[model samples]
Target chain A: MTEARATMPPGAGVVMPIGGAEDKLGRMTILREVIRLAGGSAARIVVISTASSLGDEITHAYLQLFAGLGVSDVVGIRPENRDQAGDAALVATIDRATAVFMTGGNQTKLATVIVGTPVGDAIRAAHLRGAVVAGTSAGASICSEHMVSFGSGGSTPKFRVGQVSQGLGLLSGVVVDQHFTQRNRFGRLLALVAANPGQLGVGIDEDTAAIVSASGRLEVKGRGVVTIIDGADVITTAYTATGTQPLMMSGLTLHTLPRGAIFDLTTRRLVSAPGLPDETEPPKVATLADVPEDMRPRTRRIAAEGAHTTTAELRRRPASS
Target chain B: MTEARATMPPGAGVVMPIGGAEDKLGRMTILREVIRLAGGSAARIVVISTASSLGDEITHAYLQLFAGLGVSDVVGIRPENRDQAGDAALVATIDRATAVFMTGGNQTKLATVIVGTPVGDAIRAAHLRGAVVAGTSAGASICSEHMVSFGSGGSTPKFRVGQVSQGLGLLSGVVVDQHFTQRNRFGRLLALVAANPGQLGVGIDEDTAAIVSASGRLEVKGRGVVTIIDGADVITTAYTATGTQPLMMSGLTLHTLPRGAIFDLTTRRLVSAPGLPDETEPPKVATLADVPEDMRPRTRRIAAEGAHTTTAELRRRPASS
Candidate 1:
């Protein structure tokens, strides 16, 4: 296993391993990794697990778990109202801290209450400032640019298709699906990719983290791997057909990055660093023009504003012809 | 408030509220409205709440709350894996439910765990089956076809550009935004409308819900008003310099639906239905082809494809003629 180090910038972000806490080792490892990434220590940690995880209990269990690792300075953010005011306080906390962690829960609740508020803005600012922010499970899923808002089943694609709701576009130009392989989400991700070929699809496995940097560099960490589904080279047309389904995509790329692998988002290429080991054959890179003829949506409406000429007359009269 | 009930057919869905429990009374009212829509309390109800919100203590509180309301057979599914299994469970739960309610957390989390899952399929199935599915805050936002993923905040139309992402596409042809007036998300929604003129943008205020039917009718409920931003009749071309920013939109229709008001998604008109109040002036209904010349995207590719003309002929023949 590759031993990961944390590099925290100056800002506050809470990294809580809300789920899988039964595995103390895994939780602690993730917490330590977040601390290192945020360039902070456990002492400076302010745990905010009170909203959900710490019900009735005094949050002592969590504090003890952190204290066992020499972590202190934790505080819980239990808001009276799960509305705008509460969101404001959460933002104030984030603004005051060097790193603030958001434990896994209901991403919709978090986004609904926080998005478009001071706190949401602060979180974005912290990320842009390179304050190592991390989330697991639900938290991890919301960190992407285009998030899955929930959709219908079926491996096939449909038109006027996809129930895409909003997401926190922290990681731009990419759509992320968590628990990828374990969940058989390939079809859904593919559908999303088909809908927006310009965006990259990232399917992350359980117990895995695809840590992205400020400059669009990605590093895969944890037990599982990160699958990159690039539909940039797909050749399907007409995503919305009633009976006839869209053509199956060909010439697309799928890259599986195991632990310690790095990917570049800008060029959509894998960086061959010394420490990183390549595990599988990389897929073919795609360009904008490589998009299939049919799948390309006709986004424009044209009117023949000028004179209509006959093909035969044009062919005979044109010197260029 | 125009207390018109939700009219769901037999075997339709039941929507539950869990995240915004602070609005317990409002939540129950919305629940009653959903039940009414699904055709009564006999309908099977699916309670979808975040694991975090259903904390050890709160879980019991919720269990008691529902039990008191004569609702039983509730299946609680906490998504341990943010992928297919979680979604599958949700779908399965919905499959047995006539009404499904989504508790809020992070909209992204709900989408990440549910999009492409059996649960997502179930939700769609229920919707098709005339089930009254309801989501609050984050849940409400995901109900539309095109949802706001999160954009740079501003009140101007220009600030809404470059922030759109793929949503679950539940309500096709509409964009849904939550925490509307409270957060001042109008600018972003407007930009979204201008960006995709073919779609209707809906901004749902907090503590409110919009019950939409398969026939494309929308009824507003709750405290604040629902803002409908319609840019289908835009008439400007040169909104941006290099076609980067969305073209400046003109003749945009802004409708504010207070409690009890109903809006039609298809006709782009607000009907004077009994009990449901009319809130805005009727705007001219325009199709996608009616957008202004300059504002419309260049259709040269489609024109060339349609005409079967070579680029050489288009340029040289014109000069020679």
Candidate 2:
């Protein structure tokens, strides 16, 4: 059988750095990048925007952009209700689109409105069919399989703890955070990665984009760098009430890629690609298997008798007497 | 066996109304209520304030309150390092107190400073030993068993779709949101409840609190009401690509309790309590067992396959390939 990774088709994903909406240049750059990824022009474009951002100004800008590109058709999905059927019109529009764009706003609202609706299904289908899909700010956030809900932020890793939220799994096995450096969301992202080691953390700075292709290759674009937090090789053990103290983690990989670098998601490695700047040395890569065995979580095989004994002990305890 | 609920001691919980800093009188009322629940003025009191709120002026106020009540010891947990282990001292200060009060500041900072340290362990230990730990604003938020890391605000029920951050699980199996009514956080809370049916949702309005006892009795105090969202009885079907659709949730219950009403968590019922205003009608309650069977997820039973035609079909497909 063909490998799952190998079967993934080639497609384009555009990320917008519009968290700082004060700058029109940033928005324009994002649009330009989307167009570039869509091979200069897209035939059918679908806009998935938040209700708050669906006002006249944003809509007018989109209309002008599409018109400029000589694109005649555009679909806008604004989920006002969170119920599954709330975005029916949007879903129907997405069904026949060639490109999808998610706008910024409350990601929770976006997820609530679009998720479980026909629109979500259509978005996934379009992406699978090799259509370009893009998101900005909160939109960029939900693109990852795992998401970082806002958390307390600080420089210490401890600040990063206990603040994680689930995300739309458009890009499976990955976590995305927007307004990265400008907002100082590093501690929260680290906390997210720590909580879920198997997932990759992608932090896109303002005015920047981290576009990943269907073939599992990630390319960095925009004004700032994209911070990639890979925990494939981490050994973490801590003073947990459930057990031991002094948690140890080793072999975690972190990469700060500026515009023009490519990362391979499947093999968990970095590859050379167009647009990447030359580096003195290749980026560091690590996997969990590379960590020392003692530091890893112990895998115990217990007999049925032992399990019974544990349960019996609990059962044997007198109620209140 | 003795009933677990019967033997359970009175709940020792922390209530914070600091988020209502804008309303000093309201904050004082909440503090007074906390004092009442802790069994009157003679109870030992501890004030845990952040560096921002730990200045001389605030300390003087804490001192006056403690002195007036003949309570001793008000320590400030001033972490020298806002980004690192600076909050360790604060956590340690909370360790020795009977009741710990986490003052208001940047919740993200407070969480970052306290999570995964000796202080965090001490706080947990204090709770286990029946200490009251209360926080207002950001402080109130971290008091849940599954803390809200910061979720998107919306009133929709989409599967695996909203961003959620990790929170301190002081009160497990529940989601607690502060500034509830004032900020109109009901929509977000509802969406969270829908996404996680097994988890209870509790929204504490500013200047108010839902004082939950060790025996699982939750009593309301202060000016505003507590909105309790219970989704345990919902009937949901596969909504994601990996599952079925049309989630049927029938037995979910929602309760808005004003000051003085008590809710029993063990029985999942509400009972009238002192200090609350008289209600026109008793609050309705719902439990897991009340959910209809069909609304529940369908269980797949294992079956043995013994069809020659099926075997032939599988063999034929492989041969043809």
Candidate 3:
């Protein structure tokens, strides 16, 4: 059925990692971007509920969320174990998807179940062909090559206090951690980067997303800031730090960016964000009952500036010859 | 000259590990007890300031505190490196002392500088021969076989989020952490115990001390509570948890104890605290301005009960033939 509809957008290799608990209701900025990147109303989104412990609950939530956003064709593929992850029908569903989203739960369980299987391959193939790939929380964490398996968050990085596992490899040479600032996960992410100094550590705060394009450009979206930890110049005592001791990590560069910020991941530099709509009408928007309580005045300013990309705007197709 | 004075109380094999920042001022309960354990004014105390980064500052502070508590023969030994730790005169001073106290700083540096030196051997020898061995903060941490070198603290134990290093081994099969509650070090201690289930994890809150007697009976002293983590029954997924992922640690037992509580470490059971002084006098004690502000009503109640364990009481000699 999917093959019959030959108008599918060639995958743009877009990846959006939402730092768990992104706003599902008001504005739904991050989620809407997922839909927009996947070709809006014409999108065929496949929700991978493999990481979710809630079983059908998470899958149903995404399916309903996309449907509410005016996307009619959305489906869910849940594989409980490796055997099911390789199912031909499930792999086919991934192949047909213009967007693939993995929900949050346990990254270890998710990777263990599908990483080497046919479903994982299909997801990668779809991304390679230009499909949008996005995830939330554990799902977001698994998008990187070196995934943070589990660890407690703290202010100081300790030696070997965290565990790292292989991930889906959608984002190479990167470590992604969701619910960053909210959970005080700076330590864990920094530790991961210190352990693997060559990798980039991208930490997305709650309600935010770091959207990476095929061109290696990353743009911030949603209400929260994205923290980037660059360890290229880090001089760490991680090698000599014995069990649970705090590590001495010096000279690591950190960048904290909010919405409308553009970063060039390949060049390891910040690309100036395009001029956003004028931000002078914040107080008036704050008085509007429709604005989310969690969305600060700054976010409200963006909303008032007409920076919102509505479903109608997303549905408009690009002109073709 | 040391042999001529000859009134050393035979070693009591007492090991007191104080969480950092014990009160040095009004009603110094913890420090006074250290003086009492070391035979009051007649005590010959050796202060080891190897862990301190502030040089003479830490040593001077300890010397004054001990002197104020009526211990006159207090002397300090500052070893910046392992070579200094092996000094013959320093080892000789430890040999003649009735009690040894280690000051706080960095545990990793302390252990690295002294653990294998002659001074380290003398500390163990002094402890074995019954001299009271006490330490605070980093000093307290090095009493165990496995020391928590450094790590950030959190509520959940993640996979390898902490580092562990070798310690002085004064308290076998144990790991000690100072400023436990004050620094929120519960997670690191739990992670340490989860990694080495055979070792007992003792987390002493600031201003509190866990005094382990020769018989392995642990008595709590001072204002703050002592957190004991027993992981012998813990069911953990640490073996398989890759990278900084939170571990599934189940069935671990936790005991939070305060002053006057007694515990048998060997048997892992609560040894009923000797009837604590009546708690009825708390209101009157709270009204007394002489008491420290940080001392809670419960601690004041004990203080009013004449449970002060005065230096005069310690100065009384044991009846000898």
Number of the top DockQ candidate? 2
User: What value does DockQ give for candidate 2?
Assistant: 0.03
Kindly list the per-residue Cα lDDT of model 3 for residues A1-321, writing each as its tens digit: 011110112345888889999888899999999999999999999999888889999899999999999999999989999999989999889899999999999999999998989999998898889998999999999888788889986545666767889988888767898888668776677778778877878888888899988777788887666777677765454665566654545445555556777777766656654333333435222234554445434556566777754421222223341
Query: For residues B1-321, what per-residue lDDT tens digits would candidate 2 score against the true structure?
Result: 112121123454543333344244334676766565545655556655553345556656766765555555555554534344445555566666767666655566666666666666666677767777777776776666556666543222223423345555666666777776555554466556656666677777667776766666777776655666666654333132122111122224555555566666555555654433355757544455544544533233212344343332221122223
Ranking by TM-score: 3, 2, 1
lDDT per residue for candidate 1 within B230-253, as digits (tens), equals 655543332331322322333455
Which of the two candidates, 2 or 3, achieves a greater TM-score against the reference? 3
Evaluate candidate 3 by giving its C-alpha RMSD to the native, one decimal: 26.2
Q: What is the clash tally of candidate 1?
A: 67
Q: What is the lDDT of residue A99 in candidate 3?
A: 95
Distance from true location, Cα of B78 in model 2, Å: 29
Candidate 3 lDDT at B280 equals 48
Q: Between prediction 1 and prediction 2, which has the larger DockQ?
A: 2
For A1-321, candidate 1 gives per-residue lDDT tens digits of 111122222332332221222235545555566656655453444444423444535345555655676656655554323464347657666665555555555555555555555666776776665455565555565665566656543223444334354555676677777656454454566667767777777767666667776556777656545666666655444343343232234334555555556667667666743233253656445554555544533234212334332321111122332
Ranking by lDDT: 3, 2, 1
Instruction: Give the winner by lDDT.
Output: 3
